[model samples]
Target: MRILVLGATGYLGGHVAERLRALPEATLLYGGRSPGADLPVDLATARPGPLAEALAALAPDAVVNCAGAVGGDAVALAEVNARGPAVLCAALRQAAPGARLVHLGSAAEYGPGRPGTRVGEDAPTRPAAPYGATKLAGTVAVTASGLDAVVLRVGNPVGPGAPVAGLPGSVARALRDAGPGPDAVLRVGDLSPYRDFVDVRDLARAAALAATRPGPLPAVLNISAGRAVEVRELVRGLVRASGFAGRVEETAGGSTRSAAVGWQCSDVSAARAALGWAPLHTLADSVAALWASVAGAPVPAR
Candidate 1:
């Protein structure tokens, strides 16, 4: 089987590519605007001609689109997140009619779930921000293309080697540098939101299953840990895992925090029924790995 992974150099896309490459009897092709990619195809700005030609020639069995605008203005987000899939699907429909397109989606598309409920795949998409809105548009286009496609709406992945921005990353930073003192306070965004945090390795395994498993995948699957873990608790957990002794302070971190899903959690029954997927890493396990990565030491599992 031949697979093409877009944005393979990025965090999530890089993991997906690594998993695909490790699979037996799989020919993996990676493409993006990055010069280090195996195939340099720019889906952000290029026309369909290049993609169409490449698809026709390669005839990949699957195309996974992991390229997206996580943070940008309305126009940039819509262009790269919404219209990118539209253009790529058009080319795939014409050139590689049999290819299965797996588009990476965001839990943000479901917006804030009902107060304390785990949102299913059938939940109405009420995107509260431009990122979610644009990503939802992309999913709609891919599913409507009359081709075999699936959208994996993943939760926020926390593990080693992630971008140093989110809760766990921030904690890793504090644990590594800040001494255990009264002045050692780590300021974070509003810690009131509830999030489902899956380890990136587990998410990579799910992506591999979606690409290579032998069953029909659901049109949409929520690949998540299925638990609404509060941000405050997560920060504390990371600190404990890292063996850090400090204080955490939550500020009024604006209303625009990207992954803040006030009460949104995921119902993973569909993902399990479709892909037989499950997370292997605990919060502590992920935290240890992340702390080790950031601290440049072997943070033994405590």
Candidate 2:
């Protein structure tokens, strides 16, 4: 199978491309703003003209759109997160109708689910932030495009990558900065909200499975670990794993503030039943692996 991965250099996209390359029978091509193994097509400024030309030349069997803008003003989020995928779906429908497209959506789309409620694929999407709203819009656009597509409403993908500067990256930074110093004070936001975190390798594999399945087109599936952990607990786990004795301080910043305090998780039974897929790593294991990678230690087995 020939696959085209958009946002090839991104956190999750990079993993997806790497996983595809591991498959001996699969031929992978990367499409992005920069030159890669394949052609360049910027989803941010994608119009039918350039998009059609680029995709037409590659002629992939599957197209995985992992491209997105996470944090920005409302307009910027809409352009890159929402409108970009919509335009790409349209272009793909015209250029390669037979290609199966897997869109990487976010668990943020479901916003904060009620406490103890597992957000399923059919859960109501009440996005609390501009990024979530735009991502939800992208999912809707892809579904309405009348193409062979599947939407994976993914959770927080944590793995070895650049140190994220926001709340999610705080624990990582704390682990990285662990040393004999005043318990390395690390500033954080609300730690009450619970989140379902998944390893990027597992997510990339699920996406590959989604792309290979024969479908009616435009199916929405929630890809998650089906387990919720509070931010405080996650921090404790990371601290224990990395021996990071850190003092976490709360900050009052809009961008770093938690959007909701409810249980934000998903029931990935559909993914398992349909695709026969399950996450190989737990949150604790993922955190340990991330810390080990950051600290240049051997990665533990999944």
Candidate 3:
């Protein structure tokens, strides 16, 4: 199938691009804001006419929007997270008719999930942060535009220097750029919140599958492992994976902002049942690949 992946340089989007590149007879189209893309698509600034014309040239069967503003002011976030997808929806419908719009959503859209309850796709989207709020707004706009859309609420996607959401990027950064102290220290903030971490490869796999989903698909799907992992445990695992007997301390401050969802465990049954997708990589496997990348060593599978 011919597919277009927006935000192709970002972490999740990058993985999706690489995965699609590996598949046979799949025409992959890449677009992004930066200069290093097959086609430039500035979601926050591009007009509908130009965007529609560009998309129409591709004739894509699926348009997976992975564009987002991970950290920014509410206005900036709204532009990329909300208006961006909305614009893309209109453009795709006019240009690439009959294309399925697969938008990547965050579990944070549900705010703080219940500790004991598994969050399903039908769960209320009471966003607690600007990021989630804007994303949910964008999802609503796109889906309500009478377009065939699939909003995949993905969990914490972790890999070597993945992105802003998971601990892998933070841990890898600290390990690489920390002070030259006596101990290999990895300073972090509160380690109380629990999250469901999925390997980026697995999430990428799900996205690729969703691109080729047959017939009419569901409105939303949760792509996750459905397991709660403590934040501290994630740090500890990274330390062990790095083979660094360092002093990993819980510091006072880190990122200035936090996600709406402090605890996230997804109910992935719907995705499995509908999309025929399952995670093949484990948490330890992700941690190993992350450390391997940070250490500049040959990455071995777990």
Candidate 4:
């Protein structure tokens, strides 16, 4: 199987690429703007005609799109998250319509979830911010592209190689900087909101399954832990994993999207039925792995 992975160098893409590499008889192709990528392609600004030509030449059996922007202005976000998928779909339709296209989407596309309910794939998408809105646009493009495609709507991913742009990475960074001092204080934004946190490795496995599975699949599937836990708990879990004795103070401000969506969870039953996939890592497990990877320290045996 010739599987081309875009954004293979990114956090999620990196993990997904690694998992796909282990597939039997799989020829993994890296597609990105980075040097040394097997296929030099930039989805954000890529035009359809040339991209179609490139796709035709590569002739991948599957294309897994993990390229997306999490933090950027409206134009920047839309260009990558919205326009990128649209263009990629157009090119795929022209060149590799038979190849399976697995696109990564965000749970934020579901907007504010009712406090205790699990938002299913069929839930209405009313994104509360530009990030979610753009991601939703990308999902729409992929679903309507008339190609063999599936959009995995991922939740808050926490595990190794977590980027500093998100909470997990930021907290890990802060803990490292603070050291083990009891007097050190770590201040952060509000941590009371609920989130569905999935281990990055688990998410990668889902992507791999979606890419290789035979026959038609649902247009969208929620890839998440299937349960909501307060963000505060995740912070505390990381703190424990880091052996940070300092205090954590929740400040007044944080992600505007978080503020708008006070609670979030996803119903992953469809994923289980379709791909036989489930998140295997607990929050503690994810936090420990994250601390080990980010802090450059082995987690103390408990």
Query: lDDT of all the models against the reference?
Result: 0.81, 0.80, 0.81, 0.93
Tens digits of per-residue lDDT for model 3, 1-302: 88889988888899888888888968898889777665588888878889999887778888888888878899999999998988888887788768988899888788788887789989888878788889898878776867778888888888765653646777776776764455767778877778888888898889888888777778888888889888778788877665666677787554433433568789999989988898888888888888777778777754
Which 10-residue window of candidate 4 scores lowest in summed lDDT?
293-302
Output the worst ten-in-a-row residue range by lDDT, candidate 1: 252-261
Q: Output the TM-score of candidate 4.
A: 0.98
Distance (Å) between predicted and true CA of 182, model 2?
A: 3.6
Question: With candidate 2 superimposed using the best TM-score fit, by how many Å does residue 26's alpha carbon deviate from the native?
Answer: 0.7
Candidate 4 per-residue lDDT over residues 1-302, each given as its tens digit = 99999999999999999999999979999999999987798889899999999999999999999999998799999999999999999999999999999999999999999999999999999999999999999999999999999999999999987999999999999999997889999999989899999999999999999999999999999999999999999999888877889898889788965579899999999999999999999889889889998878774332
Least lDDT summed over 10 consecutive residues: which range in candidate 2?
Answer: 252-261
Candidate closer to the true structure by lDDT (higher is better), 1 or 2: 1
TM per candidate: 0.93, 0.93, 0.93, 0.98
For model 4, the stretches where C-alpha displacement exceeds 4 angstroms are: 298-302
Best by lDDT: 4
| Model 1, span 1-302: residue lDDT tens | 99999988887898898888989888998889887666677776767777788788877898888888776688998889898999898989889887888899988899877777898999899988888899999999888988788999988788877766455776678667887665676777787888888888788888888887765677899988898887777788777766656677778773463544587688988988888898788877777788777878775542
lDDT of 4 at 182: 91
User: What is the number of residue pairs that collide in model 3?
Assistant: 0
Q: Give me the displacement of residue 102 in model 3, in angstroms.
A: 1.1
